[model samples]
Target: MARKVLTVLLPLLLCVIAFAGLLLLSIPIRNVREPPSYKYGIVLDAGSSHTSMFVYKWIEEKENGTGIVSQHSMCDVHGGGISSYAENPSEAAESLVECLNQALKDVPKKRHPITPLYLGATAGMRLLNLTNPAASASVLSSVNEMLSKYPFDFRGARILSGQDEGVLGWVTANYLLENFIKYGWAGEWFRPKRGTVGAMDLGGASTQITFETASQTEDPANEVRLQLYGKSYRVYTHSFLCYGRDQMLKKLLAGVLQRHSTHPCWPVGYSAKVFLKDVYSSPCTSAQRPPDYDVSAEVTLSGSGNPILCQQLVSDLFNFSSCSFSQCSFNDVFQPPLSGNFIAFSAFYYTMDFLQKVMKLPVTSTAELRTAAKALCNESWEKLLELAPSQKSRLADYCASATFVHQLLVQGYRFDEHTFPRIAFQKKAGDTSIGWALGYMLNLTNMIPAGQMHFHKGTDHATWAVLLLIFIMIILISLVMIFCFARSSKTQSAI
Candidate 1:
């Protein structure tokens, strides 16, 4: 009776053991359909005033359309932007060495050769190219040459159009926020409940605003159409060159200095002697340079930090009266009715972050922002420097920066109290930055297909192979167990 019981139960035990083995095998089999390895790409954001290198990595295969890229590492060049090296283009290339070395350490050695390295110059280089094409070409070539020496696959450097800059930044903002595509619990990609957000980037040499709007774009030039993950987006984008913080400051100083001596934008008791040439060298200010003034001439500026006067000074920079379109956002640029939330990044983030930190003020509304600006602008320069020792370089300009952002957004872009709070001043989303380079890299990545395994639906080589192997192993184990048990029973009977 015991032998009979053993004979019956042993096969059932073997079946249960086979079932467990099948369960254990499923993990690897499932993983086989997933991304087997990671792929990497490097993007160099060579902006007008500064350069930053970003490393991005993604799975080799994913069902969520293209690979989901996230920032792996970032390095800011020690000196000024590539355009700053106009006199010595070689130094521009050399400036990248420190950052490249960091990337070398960040990315595994094996990925260096396969990884694509790209350099995209923004408004600074654009301005340089417009003013001096040969110098621009030289800068690009030198930087390109240096990038070639590294192990990465060097993609040539090029200037991104103002429109491209704005649109790509929009893409980066939405992509990082997962506004373009979301991974569903049902194991597929789907659109999220929240709509896409607008992107507002204020850099050193330029500023950009891009958003998707249901309203028709009156000017076709401002309309940008993009398809991501099988969904379409109609976007409105405009990049105001030479309107960044630095350029904007130059504009304010020039506009104010043209008529008066004291700069209402600057804080009280602060003074500086700036050369007339430095302010008017750029194309943005070149047109504003007084014919009678010498380029090398120096003039002193005193700070007033008067809110109303400062706003008026900043407002003088925009041409709100010259709108040919039904609606315009300063400078006659046709912008559809403002829709969705806006992500203010780069200088916007850094400047607001500094003000909020230094003054401990919440800049949620226009009124709060104006009050904070008044407080910071009215404070003595010595007190500010004492409070924020690290902000020494840009400490004096905080008042002007705050004022320009306000005037530009509230007046230039027409963002009111209700819409002002919708703007999220952020430098990064998670570990990734909200910049154009990531978006540009994502667009380029579509061209490079992931070399993932291809198989038919439900019945493919990999699936069949796994199932067949498991079945054969189960059958063999069952046969062996039955044979062993039968022999044991037979031997017992003989005994």
Candidate 2:
């Protein structure tokens, strides 16, 4: 009787084990389809002069679980700075929220839960005086309260320092150059030998220059060298705190009026306060309008009146003229002996000349660059022109300076002629804000891991193949466990 029982039990166990093995084999063969819903994401690029939000949708592939993603159109949200929002955070938040909500009108309600939102504030927010404990707390409180009312979940938001922003811009610029310009659709339009390229991004609050040297071989994993400059001695970057067109103009005006007692304006120190009050309080100002171009031009020229003296002083201080600018091949036509005003004027001329004539950037000649550096000087300037139509007005000084810098770079001009270096401005096609937004989203989603992957170690295709094999084995083992439990007679009986 015992022998009979053993025989029956053993056979039954063997059959169960066989069934489990079969179930395990079937697991990998199950349907592998793309998710029914799409994942959405948004990025808020909060710049000093303005803020813009971009929204995108994720694309999934059924075969290998990988596919290209795309950004939805007209989902951008733009508004004034935190300072502007400080007075009425709710109102400011609503304005931006409305824009974002409107953008989602076309998307199905089911996909709303999958959408993620991120906010990053650059130069402008970083410069805020958060040291005053009371004011700082209020600002934070206001911002948090405002964000809580938004629809999508906020992943994270922070004020990035000028240096951080500069580096990010560099990373962003390079990513665009490699992914969009070199390999994707841009390659079809124009085929330029991809190599070491430099980028100069002049924003409203600051200017960032990045130098990246590409590898000689076609290795995608190349090391990139980055240098950032900001306001302080942060030589890697230079942030002229309040050195943007508007702030600089205000200082220039104040200085000029203070210096000349014969001015037709108000009493001593009167005009400066009045101008500042008007700038901060007036509703007529707008980002598009900026400040008065004529006033700004006069102040900047007057403020920097002795280029020769300034250059001499800088040369003496640094004790390296050749390294500075003297060793360059181009003439120092922008140098002093000429009044500081002429030097400043020449700088603008040189920058424009370099951009338009030398490298030949497309939008260099646009009215924006052609206007006085300080045309849109304050926050009010931005608000007044928020809804107005675009207009073109040439600011000869700014254009000239930009051109002059371009010329110096192309011609290999020496540094003794000027205090700064003239670098090239390379413009690639499809360089819109949307393209950047899309690229960033794709990177975050791991759609194009190749773009974000840094090839520091010598990990080649062989390494990846080995890794993939290991992963597959691990997955297979996990499937075997699931199948074994499902096939067991006792477990099935219990269920």
Candidate 3:
């Protein structure tokens, strides 16, 4: 009887122990523990006025449709824009060394060899190319050579065209907003079902306007069709060169100043010798002449502090008479109605920030901007410097720039007072700054793939956990039945 009991109990105990072991294995097998992984990319925004290095990082295994990359760190290159070194292209290349050194510190050493580094030169380089082709080539070559010395994979460093500048800026804005995926189709947010916001980038040498319009674009040149993250977006984009605030100031000042004249656009107590060559050098101006054509002449600028005259001078730059399209946004470019809300950044944010903070203006009215500009222009030089000490040298141009901004939006872009509120003045969206650099990098990396993996951690994990628990419970019940049956048989045999 004892032997039979021992034999029955031993087999039953073995079965229970084996079942328990399998349950323990299922927990770990069902729950996969993946180590964290990261990827990084570097984008160099070589704008006309300045250069900034952006270091971006993202999780290695995130969904493809969503923009997971965020700006990790950024360092502004010391000195002026790369285009400023047209005369000395070597220095332009050298200016990036400090920024690259910072990047070397920011990105992990192991990732250096595989990390891509791209440089996209904006309108300033475009202007330089137009004015001096040889200098532009030299500058690009020098910068490319310098970048090659670093461990990062040197992607082609070249100039982005006006159309790309505008459209990519739009991409950056929408991606940051998550517009493409927020209201997308089925299991994954792969298709765009919502309207994308417009983007207005105001840089030092050019301004870009891009948005989706309801009206059909008759001219193929004006329409830009893009397929991003498996979604199709038809957009109208145009970049107006020489329309940037600084360049516009030069245009207005050049038009107003007749050799040795007191320009009404200048602020009170401001006197400077503005070069004729600098003023009329850009092709954006109707009065533009070759830089060498009037290299020897200088226009003496003395401030009169007149606001009315400033608007008049800036407005004269726009040609409202010709339009082959039903509607045009100055320079005879086909611009369908400014459909969506606009994100105006770069210089737009700076000028608006100054107006809102220093001038105490709401920035909604052309009249209010006009009034504030005149007030700043009429203010004493000492007082103006006190308000913006960092911009002491350039303070004299604010009066003109602020006034020009108002006129440009109101007259050049045909933005009404009602639509003024739609324009958001922002430099960043969360951690990412508003610029085409992010968009350019995204396009190059193929980050937005045509199809995306559907990953819902909570639902998938819960389903697996529940199913695993049920499996373990089923094994426990089966083991108990076998143990009972063995005991019953042993008892009957003993009897």
Q: Identify the candidate with maximal TM-score.
A: 1
Give the runs in model 1 whose Cα sits over 4 Å from its true position. Answer: 1-36, 447-495
**How high is each candidate's TM-score?**
0.84, 0.49, 0.82
The pairs that clash in candidate 3 are none
**358: Cα error in model 3, Å:** 1.3
At residue 183, what lDDT does model 2 achieve? 22
What's the lDDT for candidate 3?
0.80
Q: Report the backbone clash tally of model 2.
A: 58
lDDT of 1 by residue, 225-289 (tens): 77665567789999999898888888888888887778887767778998888888888888788
Give the candidate number with the greatest lDDT: 1
Predicted structure 2, TM vs. truth: 0.49
Query: lDDT of model 1 at residue 291?
Result: 78
TM-score comparison, 1 vs 2, better candidate: 1
Q: Where is the poorest 10-residue window by lDDT in model 1?
A: 447-456
- Tell me the lDDT of model 2 at 86: 52
Sorted on TM-score, best first, the list reads 1, 3, 2
The alpha-carbon lDDT assigned to residue 271 of candidate 2 equals: 20
